[model samples]
Target: MASLAASLRDPAYVFHFLTPSFWSFLIGVVAAGSSLFFLALRADEQGEHFATSHNRDQINEAIRAMPEVVASPKRLADEANQGRNELIRQSHEKHARAQRAWARSQRYKVGWAASLTISALAFVLGYAWPLAQLSFFGAKLLP
Candidate 1:
């Protein structure tokens, strides 16, 4: 308790406490936490996509009947439908490509695991480095 008070009074002691290992541990934890957060967002989006993908046909049909398209003159109705059909087809192709990419990312779970593992290692290094330094210098704990 005295040492704690002494260190608090002495700013130099603060530098000793903020070592490279401590910084590395802090960076690692923040990076890992961010990765986990993004991973969760990806999973939630994937779930929502999966739920909606099944209804894609119905969704496409609904889009085809947009107010502007439906309110076109009778003479232009056929032309509008033709153009809308082509647009919908292209959109479907793009959506399919996106879905494939999402599937690939989900299949590769190693990135998240690797980040967590590296952060854990950093935490261990941070905890051990100070003790190792103290031992090497034959420093006695201050009472």
Candidate 2:
């Protein structure tokens, strides 16, 4: 047991501790988590858009239900049209926000995939390459 501990302290063997694979894997996991978080945010945004649309529909319905005694016919028509235009504008803005959130989630997903690929390549170079060198030449190629 003591000999095993002593061997672990050797510089060449300890090189494994400093390998890029561990760092890259951590980054990959963080990126994947970020992607998921953004995806949830995107869903929230879409739900907001749906709520906005519902509100707009309700506002339009209310405008249409206004009594004839409220104002002149032409004035009431103009007011109702204005209300509808405003509601449509608000709905469009909410939809735009949802689309932007979706775009952000997609970017994070791509980053996660890239980080994982880099981690895999780093593992091969940092761990496998050293072992191969040690087996064939009785010495590692890198520190």
Model 1 regions lying over 4 Å from their true place: 1-14, 56-98, 136-143
Each prediction's whole-model lDDT (CA)? 0.64, 0.56
**Number of clashes in model 1?**
0
Candidate 1: residue pairs that collide: none
- Model 2, 1-143: lDDT tens per residue? 22332466464554453444446445556655665665566566556656655665675566567543345687776675675566556656755665665566566556556655655665455555445655886764334
What clash pairs does model 2 have?
none
Q: Top model by lDDT, which number?
A: 1
So what's the TM-score on candidate 1? 0.51
**For every model in order, what is the number of clashing pairs?**
0, 0
lDDT of candidate 1 over 1-143, digit per residue (tens): 22442456554554455456668788788868966975776677566566556556665776667644554577687676776667577668657855875775575455666777778888888767767766886543431
Ten consecutive residues with minimal summed lDDT in candidate 2? Answer: 1-10
